[model samples]
Target: MNDHDLLETYEPVLRFAKSERFFPMAVEHYLERCSILPSGPLGAAGLLFHLNEPLATFIGKLEGGQYFLRFINEPLYDADA
Candidate 1:
């Protein structure tokens, strides 16, 4: 799945106190990193930092990293799931 698709995948669950737009920003960061290191493995922490303060707290920095790690590495990953 491409980085843009992450928006659609998380749109329903994505939450933000400041602005919903921050979510897309985070997704863009993730996508950018992926493009730079397509073959290299990724962690959510890399993308999570792009999020604003409230959004970062909502997801929990380290926890967010774990989530991305699992989703990216899992055989059958589903953002909605």
Candidate 2:
């Protein structure tokens, strides 16, 4: 699947892209690491442990990135650098 589709499918894991804030950590790092995850429900269960943030925040973090929040301006999309 494309990056957007892959990411959308694994929304749960992506949400924990910043678990440092006690953000929902994954049941297992293998299925949660942003650099990994197989995609779909398996990926969701991985990080669907303690996270409790709104899904919109996750989308905003992915689409808007630094534009919406500076500290969490993570790169959710492919980039040249």
Candidate 3:
């Protein structure tokens, strides 16, 4: 089979609970709402890239450092309540 068919055959299905409100979003949309932060010791230094910044700018900031995307900056409703 071709690469596309192989990938499709192995793709796993995602099952979400009825109460689950969050869902996957497009990378571009997610990037627009998220900021880049250093994942390790550098995290204390604060944010590396602000929300809505260009992808190139985000990539430019990643050099010899560990980073992660912070999608939600605020706390959500209490789930246990």
Candidate 4:
């Protein structure tokens, strides 16, 4: 999936989070961090790798709490990093 597709897929969830007045903050925070990285332009795969952990953490926090967010999930795919 390309960046556009990735965003499209997550846009609804993001919108939902915004509707609930959450997640958007976390998403913005993650974007801030990602922007600093010199990863150049990346698409869906790039985002999945770079953000899987952070996004999962954010989601977990929203769902249950920091404690509930598992850091032991399968590794994400990072392209030629």
The TM-score values for the models, in the order shown, are 0.15, 0.19, 0.52, 0.16
Write down the lDDT that model 4 would get.
0.41
lDDT of 3 by residue, 1-81 (tens): 999999999997889999997897787787777666676766535344345557545555555566766678774547845
RMSD, one per candidate, in order: 15.6, 17.1, 4.7, 16.6
Best-performing candidate as measured by TM-score: 3
Model 1, residue 41: displacement in angstroms? Answer: 45
Q: Could you say which candidate leads in lDDT?
A: 3
- Per-residue lDDT over 13-65 for candidate 1, one digit per residue giving the tens place of the 0 to 100 score: 64678745334546534543332212223544454454544332343333323
**lDDT-sorted candidate list, best first:** 3, 1, 2, 4
Per-residue lDDT for 1-81 in model 2, tens only? 999999898876434444465454343442333332224554445435425644333432332122221223365455745
How far residue 70's Cα lies from its native spot in candidate 1, in Å, is 42
lDDT of 4 by residue, 1-81 (tens): 999999888886423643573344465555434422222343322444445465534333332121212122343446735
Error of 4 at 64 (Å): 34
Give every collision pair in model 2. 24-51
For model 1, what is the error of residue 57's alpha carbon versus the real structure, in angstroms, after optimal superposition? Answer: 28
Question: Which segments of model 3 are wrong by more than 4 Å?
Answer: 38-68, 73-81
Q: Which parts of model 2 are misplaced by more than 4 Å? A: 1-38, 52-72, 79-81
